[model samples]
Target: MLLKRAIGVAAGAAVVTAILVAPASGAGQADLDSAVREAMLAERGAAASADFGTPVLAEPLVEPTRSNDQGWAFGTTTIPAPDVEHAGPHTAIFVAHRQAQGWQVELDGTAEFVEAVERAPADVVSEGEKQLFARNYENSRVAVADTGLGLPWAEGVAWWMGGGPHGDSGQSRPFSSLDFNGGNGQVLSAGAGRVYKSCLRNGSGLVRVVHENGFSTTYYHMTGLTDLGDGQPVAYGDYLGRIDVGLPCGGSTTGPHVHFSLLRGDSHTKVDGQTIGGWTFREGAQAYGGYAERNGTQVGTGGRITNHGQGTSTPTGVVESGQNTSVNVRSEPRLSAPVVDELPDGSVVRIKCTARGDFVDGVWGRTDLWNQRDVGGWISDGFLYTGSDGPIAPAC
Candidate 1:
C-alpha cells in the first residue's frame, strides 16, 4: 500500500508470488542464501548506525520463484526489531541477477524492492515471466545521463564545497553552489544540453540546461550570459556566464558563487538521485549527510568536505586482486615515471584524477591515487572498481 501510493499506482493486482509454480533448485537456494546474508549484513549495519537497533531474522527466507536463462533469483526476508513497541518486522524483498563474475544483489530495499516485485506478472509460467524479469532488470540498473558531466568550473579552478542543501533561500534543498571565493568567474555547463534562460528571477540570472536524459541542470546567480539563445545546444564545459551578486538572485549570501541544482523529470521534483563527481544529491539533507554515496560507499553521519582541490576525487577504493599482487604508483602519469608508492592488494586509496598513459597489459588510462597523507600518484585504472561512472575526476 505504501509503495502503491509512492508510485501512484493502483493496487489489487493479482499477487504474482502466489502464481509461482516451479521452485528454486538446490544450487539456486545456496546462492540465494549467500546473497541474502550479504544483503542482511549491509542493511542491518545501516539500520544499526541510525539507531534503528539490530534486526533479527523474523522468518526464514523464502524464494518467490524459479529463474530462467536470465539467471535471476527473487526472495524476501523479514527482519524484526528487538523493540516491538515502535514497529513491526520489516519485510525486504530482493532480486539478484547472476553477473559474469558472480551473483549481484540488484534491488534490496523495502518499499522500492516490493514495488518492483509486485509489478511482476501474476502468471510466471509464460511470456509474462519474461516481461517481469526484464522490468526488474531495468529497474535494478542505475540511471545515468547519456553523456558524462564535468565540473562546472574550468579545470584547476577548485571552486567546490561539500554538496548539501543549497539554494537562494538558504533552506535545506537539493543541489550545491560552488563558492566563488568572492570574485566573479566564468561558469560552464556541466554536460551537453539545451540551454534555457527564460525563468530568471530575483535577479538570480538563472540559466537552465536540459540534458538528453530529461534531467536539467540550472545555474543561478550568474550574469553576462553567453550570446547563445534559448534552445541552443551547448556541449559540456561550454562557457555559460559569470558568477554575480545581486538582490535578483533569491537568497542572501556572503560572496558571489554559482548556485547549481539538478532536477530530474522536471523542476518540481527534488529527490536525491543525481550524482556529481561521485557525490549523490541529498535533498533536504545536510552536506555529507546520510543520503549521499561516494563511489558506491555510503558517506556516514558527521562526514564533511575537507578540501575542494582541483583534480581531487572522493570516495575510497581498494586495490583489487588479479594480474599483479601490487601496482606501482608513479609520480606522473607515465610508465617511465618514478615510483612514488606501491599499493598492495586490498589497500585503500582515494582516486584523485585520471590521465592517458602508455598501455600496460591493456590498461591505457591511469588514475591518480591519494594516500592517507594526501600524497598523490598514478596507478592503472584497470585494477580499481570505483562502483561509479568510470572515472569521476578530471583529466590531469
Candidate 2:
C-alpha cells in the first residue's frame, strides 16, 4: 500500500480524517437518505471558508455508501532511540453530524470522548468564530497515507536517476552519514520552509545535497564523500558521494549510507564535513540543507483539505450522494447521500439531478450536482478546480 511503503522512507508526510455524525449502533447500515436530507436542509446558499485540521471522534461513524463503517491503521513511528520505536493502536474513524456537546469517541460499546481528551494533551488551533476547526483537521487527515495502508503516500514510487533506473530500486543507499538501519535515513531540508524533500540514499559513502524546495537528500556509509559541500546545491539524482562507510552502522545495511533528515533550522551546521570542520551557507536552501541538529520539534506535517466541492453545482436525483453525477453541478453546502458525479469539461453525460446548494472551498463556494453511481472514483478536489479566479484551493 502507498502508506505502508511510505513508512520505509520517513522523509515524506501523512494525512487523517474525522466523523461528524453519531450512529445508532456499532454495526448498522448508515441512513444515507436521512444524512443527505439533513445535509441538504442544513447546507444551502453561500458561506465563507474556514481552516481545518485532524479530527477527534465524538461517536461512531456510520456509513451506508462506503464499504466499511469503521476502521484505522498504524502510521509511521518516531525513532526515539537506536532501537525504540513508538506506535499508537489501530483506530476507528467516521464522519458524524449532531451529538451531545463537546467531543465524543466510541470504541466498541465504550463511550469515552471527554475521557480520551483528558488523558491526552493537544495543541490549540482555532479558526475565528468557527467551532468546526477540529472537524476540518480530522477530515483533512483522512485522505492522507499516514492514517491507513491504502492511502496515497506518494508511496513506493520507482527511484529514477533520470533516463535509467537507479541501482536496483530501493537497494541503493547514500554515500555517507552511515548511522542507521531499516530505512533509517532522515530527509532533512538543509533549512526550513514549506519546502518538499526528496529521497536519495546509497550505502557507499558521503552523499548529500540541498534542493530549492527547502529539502535535502544525503547518502551515507559509502566508499566516498564527494567533494561537494558547504555552499553546494543538488537535486534528487545528483551524485553526492559513493557508498562504503566501512561497516559501522550495522550488518543489515552493507557499505555506506546517506543519513537523510529534514532539519528544523535554516542551514547545515558544518560545511566542509572533512572530519574536522566544513563550510556553511548563511541563507537560501544551502544554509538550511547543511548538517545540524533539529532546533525544534515538528510543529505539524501535511494536512487534508476541507470545505471541498465548494462553489459548484450539480443535479441530485435519487442517486447516491458523494457519488459521481452525469451533470456537473458545483454547489455549496456539500450534502452527502446524493454523491455527485462530474465529467471533464466537454465530456458527454446525461443529466442526473438538479439540486440547488452551495459548497465552501476555502473562502469560495460553488453549486453542486451529484451523480448516483459515479461519486466513489470521482476526481479529487485537485482536479475539480480546473479554472476560475482562485482555482480550488483546499483548506488543508
Which digits, one per residue and each the tens of the lDDT, describe model 1 over residues 75-153?
4443333332122122334555554444554343233443444544433223432333344334334475321445576
All candidates: CA RMSD (Å) = 20.3, 27.4
- Model 1 local distance difference test score: 0.47
**Residue 312 of model 1: what lDDT?**
26
Please give the distance, in angstroms, between residue 46's alpha carbon in candidate 1 and its true position after superposition.
36
| Candidate with best TM-score | 1
- What local lDDT score does residue 229 receive in model 1, on the 0 to 100 scale? 59
TM-score of 2: 0.19
After the best TM-score superposition of candidate 2, give how far the Cα of residue 14 lies from its true spot, in angstroms.
46
Provide TM-scores for the models: 0.39, 0.19
lDDT of 2 by residue, 1-396 (tens): 010000111346333233233445542334432332233222210010000011211121122212222222111101011111110011112122223321122211012221222232222111220122223233332322111111000111111111111111111211111122222122222221111111112433223332322223333334433444333343332334332333222223323333332210121222212110011111112211222111121111111111101012321111112333333433332444343445533242222222323342321233332222233322222223222222122221
Error of 1 at 109 (Å): 29
